[model samples]
Target: MDSEVRSYRTGGDEVVLDLTRDAADFVSGRGDGLLQVFVPHATAGIAVIETGAGSDDDLLAALGDLLPADDRWRHRHGSAGHGRSHVMPAIVPPHCTVPVLGGTLALGTWQSICLVDLNVDNAERQVRWSFLAA
Candidate 1:
């Protein structure tokens, strides 16, 4: 198994950062295998979604509706409703495994790997990419 961990500064805002290019770069020159993308943060998650078509915004809106960032959570610490960020992984999940053929990710035309972060207290995030040869 080959693996690498990448870190990024997400700033203090909710975002859906695209990571397709990074994944491609990591698997460059590699062969068929499974690409596992995992986030080592409880307040963040990994998601495969259609981006740049308002889908990202729609996702954030849906999350807001489902997990409003208000003072209604018991796990209060950082920002109000920061606990919702921890609960995000339950719905979006913290990892995703995609098929890599000929060193390329087998994702759909609009599907993109993104880092979903809602935590306003932390600005740094790490994503681990592990490839298991087939």
Candidate 2:
């Protein structure tokens, strides 16, 4: 079975979406060897980051500097906004692959799967998680 998410964010400053529990719970209910987490939005990317206050802020701040949204980017012509957000896909990957061992996700001590939304304002985002046999 696959899980579909209707995600709403309070604000964007390294908000942690602990897919560990969600993924493990899903995997436990089905046959799994590997878990694939995919976010089908160009403005968002997926990564394994430490779920902490400082870490979250650092990640967002770094991303902002890496891809300044206010820069004179040609992609911002259409008033759609989030030109740098589109460029973020080039930085972090669109999906993540984690090994499932003993019917649970194997992650480092502080590692947690996160779906990063780089948009300016809050909008309903989509996150898709699927478990497959290794």
Best by TM-score: 1
The number of clashing residue pairs in model 2 is: 0
lDDT of 2 at 83: 81
The digit string of per-residue lDDT tens for model 2 on 35-73 reads 888888877788899877577678878987887767567
The per-prediction CA RMSD against the true structure, in angstroms, equals: 0.6, 2.8
Error of 2 at 27 (Å): 1.6
Cα deviation at 50, candidate 2, in Å, is 0.9
Once model 1 is optimally superposed onto the true structure by TM-score, how far is the C-alpha of residue 86 displaced, in angstroms? 1.0
User: Which ten-residue region of model 1 has the weakest summed lDDT?
Assistant: 22-31
Which 10-residue window in model 2 sums to the lowest lDDT?
A: 8-17
What TM-score against the true fold does each predicted structure earn? 0.98, 0.81
